[model samples]
Target: MNIVLTIDTNFAPQAAACIASVCENNKDVSSISFFILTTGIKEPAGKKLHTLVESYDRTLDIIDIGNIYQYFDSDFDTAGWSEIILARLLMARFLPVSVSRVLYLDGDTIVRRSLSPLWNTDLDSNLIGAVREPTASAERRKALHIADMRYFNSGVLLIDLDSWRSNSIEKTLLDYCRNHKAVLFASDQDAINGALATRIKELSPSYNYVNSFFYYPYSALVRMCRPAQYISRENYEAAIADPTIVHFLGEERPWRAGNTHQYRSDYAHYLSLTPFSNMPMEQGWETYFKAWRTFNTATKPFPMLRYRIITSLIPTFMRFRAAKRRRT
Candidate 1:
């Protein structure tokens, strides 16, 4: 099966580790091919990543896409949503023309087990296959207008490359974004969610276990109940000991040498197996936390506060109107 991963230069070291871990863990599986889609980087991070893939000359291919904004709406931010766009772009341009199916993983991910299971899953002749995102509840399912309540995670996708090319998936997605710009909450993610709403084929949670951002209580409960059933510090260690893939998802990543998350040990384990040992990890968690705080204030809090104030006064105003109505 053709295995493709896309990453910008920002996560180059993690990307190297991700590719290396996959090759290392699945020793029996050497038939995989790797391709990288470089976005904002000047020189090729893909070429640098090739050295880490074990079989150097035979296992990897670097496709320098330069900047993706050429075809996308530059108004939206991709800092948080590049993977979705890169996966679609790679399927359109990087993989072999003859290739039918492709698996695209984020740069922060590490492979712990043989990808054969994920690669071999039937897409039911659909355009893509992916582990459903944990947060996509029945409410979100309805919001996406998909009746099955299954919304696939964009993090890891098993794409039908031939179908994508034949159907012009990239063009279709771009066109959708162009038409319904406001619908896109985070550009690539929201656009793809809007585009592939009902068409997605769902896989098991074990395939793409995401850390809950805002829904911590419920997501944490789910995690605690199914520690061994999915990905976490405990399961991550187990996976590393045996190793398929580990995805350091979201804004906070495990590749940073100073990353202090509970799962940092697991990341360090796989990091030991990769070429990133010499490179210094990025800035510490303080910077990450500050950025998270800043993002929340800018995007949600103030507006939410205003909504709360308005709702708080509405009950008092409604009571006054009720008393007046009785007097009338």
Candidate 2:
């Protein structure tokens, strides 16, 4: 299986944890190759990653994507996005032609099961296989002008390099980003979906369960309010029950202290198996407070504030109601 991850020095530790989880969970596989695309990662970090993967008898390929970024043009402000986020767009350029299929994973993800099934999936004529974004809605799709309303999250992708190259997917993605700077919401994700809208095959949500899945009633409430835009209840329930991959979306990482994700300990378990096991956890209460503040500000101020108050005052009962609401 060919697994690819794009990350820089800052996210090397998290990437290591992700790699560790993949190696640990898929030990039965005969050959697993990891391709790490980065602008520049320190030697020590590289060595640590090499050692970690070598310990599991897997091959690691580190490719520099610094020079490749120069060819692409985008007016969209990349404030929170990492430089390597765009690397997946150029997979066909960086990866070898002999590599027909590749599974691209973000650094903030942990593979909980063997990815062989995903790897072996037939893309047919599709350029990529990806999970539909959990939060994708009709309004958001309409805003992006995605006529198909199939906005897939580019975080975890199963790519058919042959189809991508044949259809010029790389250039298509770059050109889309270059032309539609104003419409690009999630950066590379928006570009990929826009360019290859009809060519993307929807994968099971279990393959790329986002952090929102762990937020309990909050995610359920969003689904209830926007049933047409959200993932179906059956798929949502299946993903929550047994996710193949858990993605730590946004800045609230499990490694950071005060993270409220239900799978924080699962991340820690994988972290412990890697070379950076002793890395210090985030301390200070300020981080937690900041996350709380961000949560309150995510939606309409009044409704979010009211929800916070209800959750705080009612607690257990409200949680039960939320779960019940999810079932119905």
Candidate 3:
């Protein structure tokens, strides 16, 4: 089994940590290859990336997709979200024809446990296996006028390349970009969903537990809120109970400086194992905290606030109504 990880050069630090963790944690996994896909990475950063990968004796392949804006011109600044497109293009370019099976992971994720189960899961169903998306069907994705529930998250994927190539998944994604450029969300996520919605096999949500605390309050507080307990709502807690791989999806990522998400420490634990142990963890932590505060303070909850007020008043009015009705 060829374990493959795809990282965009923009997120090189987390990508390096991700690669290091993969090397340290899953030492038993026989074949491991790390690919850093760059549109245009600086030479110094590229050198550091090469050095880190070589230190572990892992195969490092750097695949460049030229300029990202050349293909995804909808919003040039939101290029960070284009990992899916670049990854697909990179796979087509570098993945060997002999590589029948491969796994693709986001750089933001920390591999806590083994990947063998996901790598070995039955893909006879002609599907790319991934963790099920954990947010409300209507919220996480744009309102696609289709079914209420969607198939899976794209972060941690166990791909059957034979099926992928046979089905022309890459071409289909690019085709969607060509045809429906208007409604495409900032990232290639919508394109992948459109192309592989029905074609994907839903892996356990534990594998790609999206860290949206607002949507998944239970998941957000699962570990800290319930130390002796576990819930099956999202993949992280489920994986904690029976861990194969745990993915940190959404804004509250582990690598960020002061992230409040439940599994931040879990990610830190893996990071500490890396050679950069002496590096100050607080630097990254502070950046995450600032971003979190900015997001929360700037967010307006008009609808939710209105609903809360109405809900709060309902019981009082109902009590009065019931008393009046009894007297009558």
Query: Largest TM-score belongs to which candidate?
Result: 2
TM-score attained by model 2: 0.83
lDDT of 2: 0.78
Candidate 3 residue-wise lDDT at 174:
73
Task: Give candidate 1's error at residue 134 in angstroms.
Answer: 3.5
- Candidate 1 wrongly placed segments (more than 4 Å): 40-47, 54-58, 74-87, 136-148, 213-244, 286-328
Q: Supply the TM-score for candidate 1.
A: 0.71
Model 2 lDDT at residue 221: 42
Q: Model 1, range 1-328, lDDT digits (tens) per residue?
A: 6777666666777777777667766677647778776665445554456666745334777676665666766774443344335445445765678777788887777666677888888888788786645443333344444535444567688888888888888887878777766544345555566687656676655566555423243334243333223335454434334434445664466655344444566666766655556666666566756665565456453444433443365446555644654575
TM-score per candidate: 0.71, 0.83, 0.71
Tell me, by lDDT, which candidate is best. 2
Error of 3 at 65 (Å): 2.1
Off by over 4 Å in 3: 71-86, 136-145, 149-151, 213-237, 240-243, 273-328
The TM-score-based order of candidates, best leading, equals 2, 3, 1
**Local error of candidate 1 at 305, Å?**
15
